[model samples]
Structures are given as C-alpha cells and as structure tokens.
Target: MTKYSSEFKVKLVNEYFDGQISILGLSKKYGMPSKSPIYRWVHEAEANGLNYLITKKSHKEYSQDFKLSVIEYHKLHEISRLDTAIYFKISPSQVNSWIYRYNHYGVIGLRRRPRGRRPLMAKKKKKQTRLNPTKEEKYKQEILDLKAKLHDAEMDRDILKALKTLRENDPNSKKQN
Candidate 1:
C-alpha cells in the first residue's frame, strides 16, 4: 500500500479548498483510494492550521510521551470500538482486537502481529456426546418411554380383569383371581 505523506494529504486538501479541483477530482488526481481521509485532512487542517501538514518519516520512533498519551486516552475514556476506530482512522474490528488484547496483556498487546494458529476452541471439532442430551430430545424420549409403559400397563390390567371375570363365572371358585 502506498502510504501518502501528511504533506501530500494537506496539499490535496488545499487544492480542493482553493477551488482548483473538487475533493473527488483531487482524490483521482492523487490516486487516493478514498476521499474520506482527504476530507478529514482538510477539516483538520482548517481547524488546526497548516502546521498539521508536516509529515514525519515512516519510522517506529513514537516518543514515550505519545505512547503514554494514547494509553492514557484508552484507559481514561470508555470509548466504544467504533468511536476509537473512527478517531484512529482504523477498522472497528482492529480497535476491538486491540482493546481485547490490551485488557488481557497490557501495553504489549498493542503491538499486534499477524495471528498464527487458530484458537484451540476454533481449531478443534466440537465434541459430540449423547451424555448431554438437548432438552427437546430428552423430552421426546421421555414421552416415547411413557407411552410404551402405559400401553404395557393397560394390556396387563385388561388381562388381569379378564382372568378375574373368567374365574368368577367358572365352577372353579377355589382358584385366586
């Protein structure tokens, strides 16, 4: 990805401000993928002055003060992921991941690297066991068993009643019904 310098962003914004080109035209002229950042730069420039145009070299040399300031903002402000992402010009998901990592691991979490293996839970297949039957299945099985037992009990009662009637009518009155 081509990282445009802050100065280039400011220049483009200025060109749009001066009525030399529309924001969309300026973006096309500069080969910018989107006009939103340019529009943001223009707004910032108008509010903060032209000094914001100065671009620093791409280096991992953020002062301790800056890092501390960012940490302080994160700690002191209960900002939502979307709000933080908009403020930082990053994706909301990135902000969410950063917050998650920071909460768990502190400052070191902010230094994100490409993820390696998937999390164990995600990588492993979910265990399939009948020991923990779902509610519906358990209820269905209970109903089936109850129905079977009821049928058997009804049959047994019918057979006993028939024997009793037969014994009473028969001449063998000594036999137990």
Candidate 2:
C-alpha cells in the first residue's frame, strides 16, 4: 500500500469534512486506489485528533503475551481486523500480521527476535610463558606438575584395585569392555 504523508492525510480529511465531496469523490479526485485508507484516516482523526494520523517515529513494540491476548480477543469476539485494530488503537495491517504469524507459528511467532547477523566469536587470549626461568623456578614448576600427575595416577591405581577386588568377590559380575 502507498504511504501517504501526514499533511496529505490531513488535507484529504479536511476536504472530506468540507461537505463538498464524498469519500469516493475525494478518492477519484486524488486518484487514490482505495477508499479504505481515507476512511481509516478520517476515523482516526475523529477519534484521536489529526495528530494520530501522523506516522510515529518509534513504533510501539507489543510483548508476546500482549499479542496473544490481542489475537484471542479478535478471535473470541469474531471481529474483523479493522474492528480489532480500532478497538486496540493499532493499525489493521498490524493486527493482520499478528494473526498471520500466530496462525503460522503458534505463540512463538509473536516473540520478538534480535534483528541482525550474529556477532563473531571473541578471540582467545594467549597464555604468557616465561622466556627464561631461573633454575629453582623451573625445578619447582616441574615438581608441582609431576606431583599432580603422580596423585592422579595413584587415584587411578586405587580405583582399579577396588574394582578388581569387587569383581573377584562377585563371580557373577561380567567384565565390561
């Protein structure tokens, strides 16, 4: 659909209220394809003043639950999209879009998703290594690493000894590969 400027909408609405031409006449005069937009503009202007006809810079974001309720209300009342839009003070096209999304994807469709490409993974920091360590530091580090490895090996040996005893005691237990 063509997007008309707020000024153009106000002018058309004013002309409509002038009592000189009907909506169809104004549509023909202005070469608008449909009278629905004019009707909507007039309704909005009358209900919420001319300022409401202006497109807002920041569109209102509806929550997923709010969208679900709107869809439920529309369905429960069996109302047209235009009527639901008017009741909710939202655009008819928005109502239609929500309904379409809800029908196609269930409630998850109403959820808002981040818009854009995914960010690249962060680079891992490099570990700092000592270029030349003193003999004492080198020996101490080697001792610590060897101690850790020895402790791990001792733990594994003890666990294996326990498992072997259990298997020997329980002759019915099958060995697992």
Candidate 3:
C-alpha cells in the first residue's frame, strides 16, 4: 500500500490524541488499509511530541476557485496549449481540451471529462513489411547471375578448344606453325 503524507498522518494522530476518534475510526476516516500505522503515529507523537508528527505542509484549495484560476490563466495570458502544459506540467492535449472548454462555456470547460481514444502506438502491434529486398533474396539473385556467367565462360572455352584442334589439323595451320 502507498504511504500517507507525514502531515496527514500527524493530523490523524493529533485527532486521536485529542480523544475525539478511535483507532478503528481514524483508520476508516483516512482510508488506511492497516490500523498499525495509525497506532505507530500516535505512539510516536506521544514519545516525540507533536513536532515530530507535523513534518510537512499540505495544500488547501477551493475547487471552484482552482477551476476559475485555470481558466483565467489560459484566457488572460493567451498562452498556447503547449506553453500552458509546460507551465502546469501537464500534457499539451489536456491544456488544449481545457482551452476548448473555456472558450465554449467559460470556467465549466476547465472541468475534466472522460478521456477519448488512446494513442495509436498503445494499440495492437502491426505487421510491418520490408521496403527493400532482404539479404537472402539478394544473395540468391547474385548466385543465379554468377551461374549464368559461368555457363557462358564454359561455352567460350569449348569453342576456343574446338577452333585450336581444327587449326592444328589444317595444312594452312602448318604454314603459320
């Protein structure tokens, strides 16, 4: 299971320390799967004091105001979807959709909707074909061409041998010899 923030754990511990809630109740309240961590938090708080429990600060937000700010930031600044994403550390497509919503219906457009289709690469693998002939095919064609050249060479050799025998047998061949 994921660990809770120290501030949140400390707050729960504080609440338990005040005797306002039970261990089981605190576990259920924080949606913690185990009650042991809560017990540990309370014991640690008692032994080390509240300062040990309050290790970090958490954000407080009003959802409506957050949405309005998002809309205003996009509109007033005239920021591109990609630029807004870089500023917010979100995807450009998310910023694009938010801008589309703000343009159509004001602050209501910034509210997150169900995502559409996933990316093309996320789907099944495609069977790709080679654009050029493979090494094996090229080798086979080269062997075929070599065989044709060898046959022609052998034919030339046989023709030259037959001419030599005929010239040697002729009376005119003796005059040159």
Candidate 4:
C-alpha cells in the first residue's frame, strides 16, 4: 500500500498552492521524511492533471528510444531525475535506474532483457566404444565382460549357499514354503 493516500496528497498540494507554507514546512508539519515526495506530487499535478495524483501507475515497459530520449533530455537540461520523471509521466526511480544503466553499459543497456534464471545446459555423454575395433579386440572385450558377469553370479550363488547353511543349522529359524 502507498504510504500516503491520494486525498492527503491532494490536500498537501493544495496547502502548498495556498502559499502559506513551503515544501519543507509542509513536510515538517505532516512529519514527512522529506519534501521530495511533495516536490514530485506537485510536479506530477502540474505536468499532467489532478487525476494523475489519484491514479496509480501500473508496471510499464518503455522502448529503448523513449528511454534514450528521456536520458538525453535530462542530460541536456541538467534537471533532477524527479523533474525528468514528472516531465515524462514516469516514476523518478525509473529515471534513476535508466541513468544508472546507461552510464554503466551505454544505450544498449536500456533494452529489456529476459527475466528469471537461464535454462541449464545439457551435458553431452561420451561414447563408450571406439569408432572401429578389430575383431580380436572386440572378442577380447566380450570375453572379459562375460568373465566379470560370471564372477558376480558365482559370488551371489556363494552368498545364498552360506545363508542357506546358516538357516539350516539354526534351530530358531522359521521354515517357509
């Protein structure tokens, strides 16, 4: 939610217009953190209309050219970001962000980028076999594989044999069909 309501903002702007209190005085009277918001509100009202005060801005995407123009106008006029923002009917933070990006990365930095985490790269699996193998080499590999399988089967058979012998010797062992 917004810190200040639209009616309250309008009241403050109206108070400022009455010429009784300065921005700082109004801020102090209302216990505002600073007069920056008042300045923005006043500018917004003056630039657009009173409706601009009541209406909330939704998320907007500015084109690269529009961003560049805003930046250029700001640079050329030597105005504050708030002023530039009010002039362009955008938030001051948007102007600040664009300026920052432009300074760090130039005009291309204003371009919109894809959001969220990038897709993970898929890993390529290496081939297990060579492109070509001699018949003798293939036969030798097959023999080695078969021997390994046989050894595993023999080990399993021995374990079952040992388990059976232990179960037969144990009087406490339960018999099952």
TM-score, candidate number 3: 0.29
Q: Indicate the residue-level lDDT of 122 in model 2.
A: 48
- TM-scores for candidates 1 onward, in order: 0.37, 0.61, 0.29, 0.60
The models' CA-based lDDT, in order, is 0.60, 0.78, 0.62, 0.80
Task: State candidate 1's TM-score.
Answer: 0.37
lDDT tens digits, residue span 45-82, model 3: 66556675554444323343454455455645666554
Stretches of candidate 2 above 4 Å error? 118-177
Q: Model 4 clash pairs?
A: none
Tell how far residue 24 is off in model 2, in angstroms: 0.7
lDDT ranking, high to low: 4, 2, 3, 1
Pick the lDDT winner.
4
Model 1 steric clash pairs: none
* lDDT (10s digit) by residue, model 1, range 65-160: 343344444544545544454455444454566557545654444443555686656766778752444565355445545655676788899999
Kindly list the per-residue Cα lDDT of model 2 for residues 51-165, writing each as its tens digit: 8887777657888667866777786666788778878888889999999986765555666767788658748756875245456545544554565567678889999999999
